[model samples]
Target chain A: MTAQPDQNTAKARTFISVDAMGGDQGPAAVVAGCLISAKANDEIAFILHGPEATLSPLVSKHPILAERTTIRDAVGIVTMEDKPSQVVRTGKDTSMWSAIESVRSGEASVAVSCGNTGALMALSMIRLRKLPGVNRPAIAVLYPSSNAQGFNVMLDVGADIRADADDLLRYALMGASYARNGLNVDTPRIGLLNVGTEEHKGRTELKEAYDLIRKQEQKAGFEFVGFVEGGDISGSKADVIVTDGFTGNIAIKTGEGTASLIGRRLKEAFKYSLLSQLASLLAYTSLMRLQKKIDPRRVNGGVFLGLNGTVVKSHGSADATGVSAAIKLAAQLVENGFNDKLAARVAAILPTEESPQE
Target chain B: MTAQPDQNTAKARTFISVDAMGGDQGPAAVVAGCLISAKANDEIAFILHGPEATLSPLVSKHPILAERTTIRDAVGIVTMEDKPSQVVRTGKDTSMWSAIESVRSGEASVAVSCGNTGALMALSMIRLRKLPGVNRPAIAVLYPSSNAQGFNVMLDVGADIRADADDLLRYALMGASYARNGLNVDTPRIGLLNVGTEEHKGRTELKEAYDLIRKQEQKAGFEFVGFVEGGDISGSKADVIVTDGFTGNIAIKTGEGTASLIGRRLKEAFKYSLLSQLASLLAYTSLMRLQKKIDPRRVNGGVFLGLNGTVVKSHGSADATGVSAAIKLAAQLVENGFNDKLAARVAAILPTEESPQE
Candidate 1:
């Protein structure tokens, strides 16, 4: 558990710690994703965690991954049904745990897992711990949007169901930092999500968070857009949308489900008649362009913020495309030194009881 | 206000109370909507509430509404910015108040408003009052879905920001009843909205509500599909999705935003190239069909559940089409005696302190 020598030197290849056992597609998909990442970016390497006997063959199958990937032995697996508390106590021997340990031990720049979200977060908190001023860590996802950047950063999408006013303020700060470092948005506009955009609407905590976020806007290096409605999540109103995990999780899932439904209906629309079928054939490329613009797999990773090290939780049901996209995101974050910047940003404006602002 | 004699006999026309002010498009849009509804249904009549000088001319312009509509003068208006508490105290002279009074006086089968949601709900609760056993009233909206009925009923969508275990249980009961009476589902399936579908997932209150809703499933005559995620709101997994107002409101708005974004992207895709434009022209009918299916205006009303009388809150910025859709829903609910049936269904399954269920 001691810190390993920092293999990720300034000019050296970036190493990503990946859990290859827990994904729905198994080690093969993980290895395939790793090979895809290695082929696409020569600077990326992976420390694959799982049963060596199971993963070694998969890694060997991909000649491209042979030199770029290392298989680490782990005996256990954290099932989807495993409680986070139970995993924290007994999951030390699991691939998910080992993957996070690599980042904690400084052997890898970031960690990626397509396992149980709660367990991965629990393990990340216990292993790497939280940043100095952070009371609770959050999971930030890049939601497809109509903004110029094509996506918006929304957090805490299921790390914890409840977040008080201070936790919300911290999410705004962390989310803004992620947008700047990860999404490349300078002076990111931070919006506190509520039922309505009116200052008088929404819960008491939201109003309190509004004032707190506004006060720290200048020091935190972000713009406060006052309060935003749920519809503004995908609109161009803000680059970073912050809310408690309970509402954030529901909003993100609801958005995904709605998009999926529309996609299905669009397909159905094209098959209704012979003329429509011919039209679909003529507009195939255009339809593909639209589909690519809103595809959920293109933005698959949910970055866990406030932790000492970066951890990206891929969807449990993600395929190779999703896993590859997550790895690409992890590499991008590592290259940008997202963790260090986020830590500094949060610590700089963190409110204190003795401070005059309070 | 005294109760007017019931003109709505078994064979008589159904009278609808309309708030002719407070909409974004003003009273013109309200009168246009009334004309649309009057022309569509011969068995419907309206009591329009607004300033006499303003509404009389608008109603007179529509020959179809001349005999079907009655104008009631009210001096004041409820601007969207007015606080719900303030409206409750000084809103007696407003059109929104007068419209609710029509329902309270038994002159109208239902009340319809395209005004401030909080003000409408506050006024509805104060004038119409909650049902005998209902503690907090909830607003239920029909969400576009993949179900056979083409939509699912989701409740507590911005009625109030909070709902405890007991209140959530009531929402489940009322939502199920709505699916049966309003949507005409034989035996509606109810699902508790949670971050995850697992038994171990979500808040403590959700778990408690889960057990309570389960106990009444058989007696309440609805199937309890335990612990549905936000994705299920638009999926075919359940017919009724229940959650607290804060989460529900955000989820619905998020869905609308996502759908609207996709629609905009689709339009942009059609305009990307000459070939795509030709394809769009060729597939106009099919695309129109798809547009009509997912159009927000088609399912525009948010029905206030747990109230003694039926009150439908149309979107504040709803156009004539949206307003007409709301009126259609109100007329359908009145024809089916939805409020009385809802009350009876709730009272029948309501658990009492002395009851064995408690």
Candidate 2:
């Protein structure tokens, strides 16, 4: 697609604010994505915040963008190489902090960033705070499927590494909301990713987490399925999969690596001999299709859920296409009012004043 | 592939013992696999071990099988469903135990099983004992790759969970030795799998392990490469990647899941409509080629390296083809004297006086 400059999508109630200098691709891709969103649907407003020196030139090219897109400049906060511990002290002046704070202040409905993940998370927790009834936040990502248009959502990809049973339940609830709002799946099937599918598998924490998920209060509108193995991440057995960030990150990266390996190896094999080249040529179209299915850039990135507002964490190594995808996802989340619905759902599950801690 | 009778196989130096009751496919697939191996490679032997009541009649159709095959009737053993703690107590008279003993007693060169991994691991650790200069035994397997005829080789798939710095170094040495003798890769480059390739990145275990690998007592006939990501598993960047079993297991399972997913998705995408189906039909030969390239079953299983004698573990759910591959790998490991080479190599790396401590 063509990414053009635009001030406003359609006259919609929701607005998605994106970090102007986030991600490895810089602001051009995000700007292009905003332009693309305007060309397609006009129901969302694009809020871009970052260094004006780098973003304004890209925005000025598209004459139609003057009214459709608005920009805010931040002094600057975090970089991909910044230390996670440093985000807390230095985020006051960073673009990521400014972008997130915009959502918290209600100037924008949601915020997205492809900057330092740890910094984004740290700033989000400090600025957005937890949704009233939630504990820690979760990062939910959608892995695109080629045969199917819908995506499988993995929660807590890199946010909450060491999670307990209750944390897992909250992750599931958030993931379900993500699946429903992002993909529009009706009653998304949620599964807890574990070492085994058997009831008695996984470590003690996972076992306890399994029971916690089964509690009536935790299984909200979505179908809380049983255990899922690493295999389920690729297949369409579940729309939403909940796991600690450590395993989820590894799973996502492993899938990405394997797909890339497939693509690269096939290319290398094609160069080996004439017969192989002929075979590779024959399979070219199919390989291209499969690549699209596994392409990290096309799938965009994941959204860090459970924050007071919106904050999308794109991989630092992601390319222009990936940045564009993140921009689109941020818009979708904002237009869908994901946070409000998520907060409402979470409040219903959390123990209230009447049901004080046991 | 036709499986020769046990006697026929025994006549050749390439004798391989198989546990008939192991794996999800059970006896039928194991029997079929034995026949296939015996028939395909005349130099290979199939020392079938299981209940005589179950095996004798299966090969009775070919009267010539009497001279070729022999059955060692085992009354009982550990089932895959059994817990690891009870494997030894309950599997006293089992086929799995008997098969491993065959290798120890020189009755067979290698014992291959596709049974409960936990049980197999516990039994092997106790029965085989660690080789000289080896701290802990590791289970290493070959992954199907696009670079060579097969996939990349990796170690510590699931044998030990909590690997220390020294254990990783030992695994690297064993994997390097296996690559040199078994895969015939001279001066094989070994890599440590971590979250990032940078020296300071990843969990503390990884960072410590990386330093030891990069600056440890150098081993002969091996190149110590730096850290690699999950992508390298398929990229052929390094032949052997050393890590704790937990992460390795996750990576392998995730890779398998993704490869299957990519294949399924491409098929669906190709068949989405009349137009796509036309493209798919045109690319059928290519699709077949891709499937063959990424088939996990073809890799079959991995060897429990660092054991006193050779032992190979097949996937619990392997089919006849998978079992056949495992049998071949075990036989090859014996023929190559893989353990002997690894023992000699590792012995030279450490002090002889500390051998007892190791």
Candidate 3:
């Protein structure tokens, strides 16, 4: 979809705040990604934060990017090695901090970063702060699945290592909002991640959260599908899978590792013999299609939800395609007004002071 | 490896008590698997438990199985739908109970069942009882990994939802012993499963478990590798990954689901066009090799460790191949005297009354 016409007259254009440094591929890839997003959507604009000298040459190479982007100079960079606590305390001048500042200052609709995950999360939480009644903010990611849209939303993927029942309930509401806005599902089916689907299984907090989520189905505008096992994460049964950050973090990584292992072995198999190499050539298109289906780079953004503003985190190792995907996700969330809708959803089902605790 | 030939000469053979019913594929598959194991290893014998009429026909069809197996009549069956508590309370006459009874009575070296996991675990714990100083028993399963043996041990797949620091320590000791016996790892590297390898990350218990497992490195005959993430589960970095049953169960299933999804997509890719189909034919051998590498059926059994006697739980949906794999694992455990070694290992590192609580 090209930039919407009305020449930016009917509606205000969305400006995405981007941290162009600290990624594995550096500012060049991030700048190229901004150009790609800008070329795709005319209504898109960028507030690029980085070492201005380095990013300026890259942005100037793409004339459209130079015209549509506003570069902000930042003296510091948050390396992947920097601890979250350390970054939060002393990373004030970092590009990551400046990127979040644009959102915090209401100069940008959303922020996209390919920095250290912990630092990005800590910085985002500290700057924008959690929404009212949000005890824990979660990172919601879309996973390739056999669903109608070929994706499922899973949340709490490493934001907080611990989550109580109330925290999990908020994840359900936030994840549902993400699925609805990000994935375009009208009424997402939300499932609590568990070892088993039976009501008697999993931790006590999960059962408590299960009951709480069930109570929110009508007002929350989603379907509560009960407990979903790990298999359901990729299966078509659930549109949104919610869990404590600890389990979600491990499960997502495990999925990634498993996919990579198989892909590596498949490559080895196709290169084993002369005839196999010939076969690989013949099956090139099909192989590319399969690769596209499973490539982690294609779906590269993890939305840090429950915060006052939206932040999309691309993988640090992401190339141009990955960065562009994160930007596209941020733009979509902005167009859908996801953060405000998520706040409303969370506020509706949030636990009251009089609610009993397990 | 063939069975030891001193069958009736130097020592009594290892007899694995088998539950001949309650599997998804019925008695035929279980009996066929027993026959395969007995034929491969003359030293392997079976105390097959099921209804006399049904199991006799299946067992008799395989002459070798009939010869090496001693039929034990069990009037009832513990189904997949049966609750663990219900089975333990009223399943005395079932094959699952009878199978575990053989181990408790010293009539069998170990128990192997292709039945309900929860029911099998419940029966095994009730009959064999927990080992001394063990707070909770864990189910250890070997996952396909890039390690030397192409497998790494992970526990508790679904024995208990909760694991305190002490329970995790026991899992480490037991898992290490299982790796030594099952995978023939000389000095298994025990890793505490967490969101990251960093010491300061994850929940309180994981950090506590990390400290506990570290202190047992020397006495437990294992190497402490500190914290490991989900990617390490499939990586060669750690030999035995320890976690609570809740996380382990979910991770294992997620891995299984992921592998299956990739496998299915690969098949689709190879059949997308006539050229790809011809390529599939030319690369058939390599594809088969790749398939075998990631096949869940090849790695079948989940060993319920930390009990007075050993019990191996096969996948309920296992075919003859899966059942044979489980039986082979049980035979290997018996041959290595794994249960005794595990008990001794736990008794050595188990926390005492004076240990400080977290």
Candidate 4:
């Protein structure tokens, strides 16, 4: 039986479409993450996509999740090895596709998935499509920083390998919006990533992007701090760093590798001798605090910007905590109306042309 | 009058040209570093460039340094703020220029400087010129890694923003040579930096470079590991990582920034509470060992390759230890005949073309 929808109750509820397979631990981790998220936020609901037989049992393990979830049968799974192009052509029955379709059909406010990044992005682009005036969609990520909010927004982290001056300008606009709504920073300071802070440095395209982004200071509602170097990514220099996908992708990976290297060295140092072992025990509390502060799982989402619907990509190897963190981020973005506001902002700034087909 | 050179003794001696001014701490650190190297190695000597009045007193501070150093008068100091273009026009009197001229005129085997990067590279290109068959020169730096040798070599860290297939091939050749001689890596494994390891990933130029580099495995005397991502830079997977200057520059800077951030956070954790403060005291020895292992000063020089003469760029803010490390690297390269060997390797692999003037 259908009942009349209560406007206040309906507005308060937020539905998240989730791909319940393809993560490192399969559907179990995804369901566990959803349970954690649902317990934390009572208003959150999910439309889980995967093989109904496998996902339903996992959902029933948590009574609360079983009450707040709806399972959709999707037998096909997009594995990490699947090519993005191939996925686009024949991935309609996969959980990733079904999850994205829910967002496109307005059945869910946002989509979150722990799957093949390339395939997920490809399916997202093809299904949700780009917003009007959007040249190319970008992947905006949160980098640990010494800022008040403890994070900085960096964009184009492997969504595309190339970006012209105009694309960079669009990144600045969308990245600033994300920093404002997601990171809760007002008038976010945006910087163009380059080899040096000097205006004469870097590629010619960077110089042109600098000029374009500078002109949009008033309209885009961001403080253009000119060009910033790589150190600014972790330093308290800027709230948003814009770069082409190639450099950003490499830079982010390099940062992760360095962190891992140092972390391994630190552990070795702590285990060097009995005295050091005792010291580590005494310092356990503070060490745990430091570890929690830098845990990658706490910041697991890479939001796909410049698209009509919001899509959050969780790390492929993410555990339950990481998946929950991603869902939390997606919920925050949905509540803030990030996609609609970003689309409106882009439309207002750039000259309207025929929107490109996916 | 100069005495007749004793063939064996003269061949054993290696002269390093040092720019003793415009560093963060000026001539004192340079003189101190030279003293350390002079005492540590009897065959090393220096051509110290700076105002004699300023450098003579510092050289006298260490009696060993005074005996091994030859002071040259260069009144003009190329400050860090000097523009590269401006320096090219009228910087002949600067210490940086004089130091490089020593190598150019065959008075010194190699040049080492802690001055502005752009100006130093500009002067080096103008004075040393590119080796025949070389498209563009690259800056190769030793990064701390988990390898048994404790380092990996990465190139084009900020030399030029672009690298074609040929340029990348040259980087692989040059980088492998440095890894063998500088890091003592035998038959070094070279990896091309990309966003992913897949053949289909990265830009069009990278795929072309992959194919070109693959053909040079036997000729260059190195193993090609196809494509590697940013994580491989610090991992033990490769001895040499090569990429265009733009990505390499950002990657290196991001790595440094991440290390700094983690180092700071660790120190904060150690000082968080009274119990942790006590633990810090107990772990001082192991902590110091860890610090010494990852110290930037131990690997201080960035060797400029693809040029006729060797030029080493020390960090602008290098201390005495850092300067000594750079000098040690230059001595090793000179002993290995790195420049001559690199030139021969390039000629053997590619058709010789008319060299381009800077």
Candidate 5:
């Protein structure tokens, strides 16, 4: 039967290792996120890696997934409470470890975790190693930018702290690749976060990086549209904005806070008494649509790039829906041959360049 | 005749030096903000510092405050477009510098600027110098916390970038003083920002700082309540949150972004169609009240404590209302004898056991 199928000349489906014990709500939320993800597409298969004692019974509850999902027993589970170095050291037998190993050994195309982030990243670096021609990798998530699609992708949310000029250029390249293939865009534009749009503004490092990004754009065939301030992080002014984890984290939090404060303020304003509640009923649909658009849960996951394998990390406080969306994304990224394509493209370009080699 | 009704004995009226050309809108907006602030109180005198060419006519427009507001001729205005260090180096006749000088020479108790911050700060540090026992001072802004009064305070928002363990302790001390004297709290609690709340969760520097803050709290008289995460920046968990300028800036931006995003989304959600516009009309009065409660303009200014002379920096984008509120705050800080009280408090206690000189 294998020979007969091989003769048909079609590609084999990609496999993903999912750490079911990784999220805030543990296996239940992860399983729910996975189920939602699995429901969206029928082509993807998952290897659930975790302690059999706790997870075997949990998976048994869903009869439909019995065939589509299989288990890889792991002795440990990385806890959110664990210290960074402590988790990295202790997670060898954990689900996160097994999942990363699967991707490394060619058994799985991608791995997904919503676990102790510092641990996941630490172990991931050791397990898969960085892609050739890349230094430190970055984690990027979708933020609601007031653009046509209602979101823009921002990188280096937490992965790399002290990124230099080369690292940023690489981020721009990877983000461009992701936007093109993953988001299905034809041309992706990159912007540098700054106090002002003038080329002369920003710190020395950013200025140097700006020049490098511009030079690379001139030759590397991506659009570099110049600098963007905090005000434009919300919209069509730019596509992929690059900044230090320090600023990126600040910007993200600021955006999140502003969204919450404004929402609460507006609610309090329109919600004086019983009549205002009635008024809300009339405007409820539009509100729901916008809420659906900006809800963090909907975009609750990020992709940690530059690792050897494709690993999707969900937000620490993600619920079932968020976890599910991450699962679907992990499945899609692996299915798209993310690593193979990115590696091929990088290898194709970097040999002639002066960058240090693997 | 020289005593002029014994001004010192007659309730010690406050004097404020206002940066007439600091903000984005310049003299007109500053003048407008002053009008509202002037309306709120009657015992304050404003020493407006800026180019006479631009400000003289603006002051003339408000003939009501010919006596209360006086225009001092300065050659230039500090432009946000200029580099902070460059402006400080080259612009002596600038409005920001003249305003700062006015404060230092005791012509004004407090200097309020909406000018280029780098220049403003440089001028303050160069002129007024530091308070005794303070290594470096920080700009502590009272942000909306989950307190009963709907406010909490954070420090070093954008004052200094490279804050060490001792600097943070100093910030905490000053913030505590501001809380006790300005906000009127009996015992204010302090928190240090880290990735996690656990004792062992921060970086080496943060851990080092954490230990010092704790040691100081126990050994000294300060109330040290443990570590806080980014989420705690909003909630009523701590009265004073201290972090480096980098983290503090991030926290502040995150808070601002969240508030603005919520407001934007609400407007879009509620005003989608003509009928929904009618809904907004029905709840207009309550919305107005909520706006008054949460608007940034109402809490326009932030005090730059720990200087020999009091200084406040309003947001560059601050409108007429924000400027007015800033002026009122400067007056209050001066009238309350901020410098004398802080100095006395610092002197009363032992060096390490001393009250924070906010």
Candidate 6:
């Protein structure tokens, strides 16, 4: 059935292409997330990609999404086990490919997926292509931080296993731009992630990138905070933290794991005795507030930067809340015209082929 | 005055060489830690390395240490800003150098330092030297984990920045041995840290190291779990986590930062309202239990592996509790004869120059 043209549609709604089949919770969670977004936002819509037989019924269950959702059928599925190289060659009929195709076709402003990260990245690169002057595309995520903004932008979480000096410079510019538009920070400060804050520490490549990122501070409209250790990732030292994919991927995951472990232990502590049980009941509201402050589900999406179009990779096991968070992030980026601004920001300071040297 | 030869010392006490002047809290904390350890364990002794004028007074204040501690008069102190190269060339009189020298001269079974990590590692390498068949030395730290043992062993935290296939295999062997002898684990399980558990994912060096590590599983007396993600670092998936120094450093620091942030937020949450404050009082014991479970100070020491002598690098800002934890770890390793066992473990599985192939 065709989606009805609602009154909000006439105002140029931002369309988010979502893959409905790949998440561990399946299509129902994706549809529920869309309903949550649709109920909260009138200027957003979704083009859901999956088997019509499955997604149509799920969308029908949510009356709010009936006017804002469109289903596209695809037979193939990209499981967590699917190899990215194999998916690139033979994933034409997959829902993930179809979801990205909507963004490539200019029908959607951004694409959201809970599929295999490697497969999703491979598909996005092949479909959307990298923006000008971006040697390598990076995945940027918002981390829970003690900054005034309550978050910090860190890049190259797992886009590729490696990044060089030029790639890091591009990440700094693009990440700073993201902080400006997406996070709305004026003159975002950038910090290169290293083992120590010392000038002569870390590997040779990090030392080389240190000078490169610092040189572009004035021209890029950002402050260079020199080097930062992993402790600074959640501190108020910088608005944007840049690092190679290998280190970034491990850092974020370690943060996630540590937070989860503390959360679990807190629950157990509250159940230890009768007094603790009553204390937990009395402190439930405050504990919930503390939980919301560090909730990973609240910051669920990892935005793939340096691509022609915006792509938000939701956690593979994300529940309805996580999916909704990802959708909200995608909507915000689209509303702010983040991709176009990021492209302009990179092009402005990028060295030309004639004078590659800074 | 000379230290009295106590009954415990007559029974061959394990002497720990301690650098007292370099910590942020100065020698007072070091002396306090020795007092704590001396009161707790009768078979432990210390060779306090620093300017005698500063340490003598500090040691005098702790009666328990009067019979168990000997002050070594080293004139120079290695500040955190001192370069490793500079310290190695002219650090003969530095407390850190003197600490390592005590271990080298066969007076102390292990050395514990709260000095510059680079300087400590450099001096340890110079004085203790690498064991036969060991290429690059690694720093092994105990991470709070969900394992039955309450901790996991992770290596190469920041000793060196690079690890090739052979180096990774060595880390696997060394980390596994540390888990067994230090943590009292039988047939410790080893996991190579990567961005993903998938065999096809991560760098080529990792894939090669995976096979090389797997080849030594039976011979090394450990179970190789193939690959593990960052989340598994705190999970019960493996007892020993192996990684390059750069990633390991970032992971551990990220864990520390996140834990610290959660702790600060929890305090604020408890102070949000009067009822919450009262509830926090009731939950004080339980919350403290949870806090003690994840306290970084409880696991404050990073052990230097692959060297002829064992060295524990305590946190620079460690207080009495932290320093005591480091001393306890050093005492345990010395009691277990960890260095000799680790060297033997490496010599058994290490590829010989005559037959370098697996």
Please report how far candidate 5 places residue B342 from its true position, in Å: 3.9
Please identify model 3 stretches exceeding 4 Å from their true place.
A1-12, A350-358, B1-11, B350-358
lDDT of 1 at B155: 95
Evaluated at residue A325, the lDDT of candidate 4 is 98
Write candidate 4's Cα lDDT for B1-358 as tens digits: 0111122344457888999988897788888888889888888878899999988888877777776678889999999889988999999999999999999888889999999998999999898899988878999999888888888999999989889988998999999989988988889999999999999888888999898888878778999998999988998999999999988888888888888888899899999999999999999998998988888888998999988899999998899999999999999999988888888888877642244222
Off by over 4 Å in 6: A1-8, A351-353, A356-358, B4-9, B351-353, B356-358
Every candidate's DockQ is: 0.83, 0.35, 0.77, 0.80, 0.37, 0.87
Give the DockQ of candidate 3. 0.77
Tens-digit per-residue lDDT, A142-249, candidate 5: 777766666677887777566787788777777767666566666778888765677875567878889768767744557998887666667677777777665675
User: Candidate 6, residues A28-79: lDDT per residue as tens digits?
Assistant: 8988888888888998888999999888888887677877788889989999
Best by DockQ: 6
Q: Give candidate 5 misplaced runs (Cα > 4 Å).
A: A1-12, A51-64, A87-89, A194-208, A225-232, A261-271, A344-358, B1-11, B51-57, B60-64, B133-135, B201-203, B218-221, B343-358
Lowest lDDT block of 10, candidate 1 chain B: B1-10
Question: What is candidate 4's lDDT per residue for A1-358, written digit by digit as tens?
Answer: 0111123344357889999988887888888899899899987788899999898778887788887788889999999999999999998899999999989998888999999999988888888899877778999999988888988999999999999998999999999999999999989999999999999888999999998888878877899999988888988899999999999999888888888888889899999999999998999998899988888889998999998899999999888999999999999999998988899889987553234222
Chain A (alone) TM-scores for all candidate structures: 0.96, 0.89, 0.95, 0.95, 0.91, 0.97
Classified by CAPRI criteria, candidate 6 counts as high
Give lDDT per model, in order: 0.90, 0.74, 0.88, 0.89, 0.74, 0.90
Error of model 6, residue A341, in angstroms: 0.4
Task: Determine which window of 10 residues in candidate 5 chain A has minimal summed lDDT.
Answer: A1-10
Point out the higher-scoring one by DockQ: 1 or 3.
Answer: 1
What are the clashing pairs of model 3? Answer: A3-A42
Instruction: Give the RMSD in angstroms, all C-alphas superposed, for model 2.
Output: 4.5
